[model samples]
Target chain A: MSKDNKEELKNDTIKENQEEIKESETLTEEVLEDIVEDEVSELEEAQNTAKEFENKYLRVSAEMQNMQRRSNEERLTLVKYRSQDLAKKIIPSLDNLERALAVEGITEEVKKGLEMVQESLVSALKDEGIEEVPVTTFDHNFHMAVQTIPADDEHPADSIVQVFQKGYKLHERLLRPAMVVVAQA
Target chain B: MSKDNKEELKNDTIKENQEEIKESETLTEEVLEDIVEDEVSELEEAQNTAKEFENKYLRVSAEMQNMQRRSNEERLTLVKYRSQDLAKKIIPSLDNLERALAVEGITEEVKKGLEMVQESLVSALKDEGIEEVPVTTFDHNFHMAVQTIPADDEHPADSIVQVFQKGYKLHERLLRPAMVVVAQA
Candidate 1:
């Protein structure tokens, strides 16, 4: 071949080789970019999943704690009111004892015996968180007004005039409301 | 230059280009493999974290349910025995009423009133889950033997002769054991 032709052929071959190298490099770069994008998306999805789980965990944990607290409160209330039913049952017996004491012409010894028994019963009731409802003032929540009487100097308006049946309480809860006569203006 | 020298130079350049392409391909493959490994490990880690959170949630849920069940049981027990203390307090009053009845009463009206009161009180107690303990046979669990009487044709050995103070129960629980006299051979 002539010198010029050989030189031209060599230049063409070198250019082709450079183009192929550039193309391969670009292809490798594109492939790497695609792999990187896939990894980033996967990481983001995993992060979102973790965030979702964390939120659910926190909500469920709070709910569990709230339930525990509520259950404890209920248990405490149950213990406090444990004697309510029994205290109600004993009211009638107490009324009967009081009636027996009011009977006329009883011997001193019998009256003394009844008084002792009544005192012991009162103590027993007090020990078990039972107490008489206060009757100095009229409270609708704790007293039931069965009769209304005209207000007087001694019994002012909205005051408790007389308790027909004594009310009892177990702890903070009322076992029975006092049946009372209230004074009206 | 000779044709042979030019040919040799061109062949050497082509060989160098091929080696460079092979080297780039091997590097690309290694990098891709590393990226894939990283993604797989990340996915595994995410799955492990999710599993851990799920396990914790299940355990906490179970604990909360168990607490709820236990609280309910406690509440039921509290309700069942609610009248025990009150019934115990009323026993003394009942004893007093019985004593007054035994006394030689001069008036029939007083006796009748006392009887009516006693019956009403018993009914009230029954309504509150209080009942008298059975005393036909000697039972150590429900009866307290204060004295032992000689067995006869009427009373067999290990049988209850007389109840001193009547025993009472509130629901399934023993409120008071019966103070009794047992028959002995």
Candidate 2:
């Protein structure tokens, strides 16, 4: 072949190789970018999953702590009101003892014995956080108005006129309301 | 320049470009591999964290359920034993009433009233899960030996001869041990 023809051939070959190299570079860059993008997204998804689980764990832990606190408070309340039902059941018997004491014609020994028994029972009840409800201005929470009398100059409205049945309380809770006659306007 | 010289120069340029492309490919492969490995490890770490958090959440949920169950059981037990203290205090008073009834020279009316009070009180106690402890054979768990009598044909050893004071129980728990005379060999 002529030298000019040969030179032309060499130029064509060089240009073709350069184009091939450019194409290869572009392909490698695209492949690398695609792989990196896919990996980054996968890693992000894993991180998101981990965060969600962590949040759930934290929420449950807080709920458990709250439940424990609530249960303890409920336990204390239950202990405080433990004697309510039994005290209610026994209040009527106390009334009976008072009635026995009020009876007439009992001998000195019997009267003395009954008084002793009554005093001891009242003391026992008191020790158990049971006590006679104070008779003050008639409050419906501690006194039940079975009868009402006219309010006069001496007796104000809502005043306790007579306590027919004494009321008792256990701590702050009422076992039975005192059955009483109240003055009304 | 001569055609030969130009061809040699072109060949050199093509060789250099090829070498440069090879070098670029090696570098690209190394970088891509490193990035992929780093991302994969990060993903694995995140997945492990998520698994750990999930396990923690499950454990906490179970603990809460167990705690709730335990608290409910304790509440029921407290309710069952609510009357224990009050009943203990009242037992001595009940003994006082019995002593009052046993005295001689009481009028019929006084006796009747005393008996009525005692009966009502006993009934109230029974309703509150209180009951007189039965006097059978002597048992230290339910009886206190205040006096000991000689064992004979009529009274066997470990038998109860007389009861000085009645014992009582509230539910399954003893309120007070009975004061009693026992027969011993």
Candidate 3:
């Protein structure tokens, strides 16, 4: 082949190599851009997953704390009202003993024995946070109005006139409201 | 400039361009490798964070469930033992009534009234899950061995001879262990 033709062919080959180099450089930039975009989306997805799990953890932690608080409150309330059921059952027997003491004609010995029993039972009830409903103001919360009477000057309006049966309470909880007569205007 | 010098200068320019292209190609490859490594490590870190959050969420959820279960159990126990405290307080009063009934020379009316009170109090206690501890066999759980007597055929070893003071129980709990004489060989 002629030297001129050989040189021309070599020049063509160099041009082709330069074009290939340019193409590869463009491809690198494109590939890097694509990779960065993919990485960003993947990182966002990972962050969303982490955030979701964190939210769930926080919610469950709050629920556990609330449950503990509620349980403690319930325990305190139960302990406070622990004697409620037994006190209710014993109140009637106390009423019966009081009636027995009220009946006339018992000898001193019998009346004394009955009085001792009555005092002890009442004291036991008192020790357990049981007490008769106060007969001061006619409060519906503690006193049930079985009968109502006209308000006289002596018995002011909404005042308790008479208690038919005693009402007892265990702490703040009313076991049975006092069946009573109230004076109303 | 001379034609030969111009040709040589053009050749030097081509060579410089080629070397620059080669360096850029190598840098592109190095940059791509570093980017992929960085992406892999970042993804791993993200995944690790997500896994950590998931584990914490699971732990907290389990804790919440366990707390709820425990709270239910505690509530049941509280309800079951609700009457225990008041019943304990009332037992001594019951003992006093029993002693009052045991006294000699009381009139029939007084005796009847005392028996009625005793029966009513006992019934109330039974309704509230209070009961006299069984005196069949001497059990330390429900019976306190205050006195010991020599065992005979009539009272076998480990049997109960007599209860000094009656013991009582509220459900499975011993409110007071019976003071008893135990028969031992």
Best prediction by DockQ = 2
RMSD of each: 3.6, 2.5, 2.2
Global lDDT of model 2: 0.86
1 or 2, greater by lDDT: 2
lDDT of 1 by residue, A31-73 (tens): 8898888887877777677767767777778998898788788
For candidate 3, what is the DockQ-based docking class? Answer: medium
Candidate 3 C-alpha lDDT tens digits along B88-175: 8778778878887787887677677778888888998898888999999988788999999999999999999988899889889889
Per-residue lDDT tens digits for candidate 3, residues A1-185, read 87566556656656876887789889999999999889878988898898899898988898888889989999999888888877887888888787777777877766777788788788888887889989999898999999999999999999998999999998888999999999999
Residue B177 in candidate 3, Cα distance off native in Å: 0.5
TM-score to true structure, per model? 0.83, 0.89, 0.92
- Give the alpha carbon lDDT tens digit for every residue of B75-166 in model 1: 78777776776678777667776776777643565566567667877898888878899999999989999999999999999999888888
A18-121: candidate 2 lDDT, tens digit per residue:
89788988998899889989988988888898899899999999998998899889888887777777678777777777788788877788788888888877
Lowest summed-lDDT stretch of 10 residues in model 2 chain B? Answer: B85-94
Docking class of 1: acceptable
Question: Which runs in model 3 stand beyond 4 Å of their true positions?
Answer: B1-14
Q: What clash pairs does model 1 have?
A: A86-B83
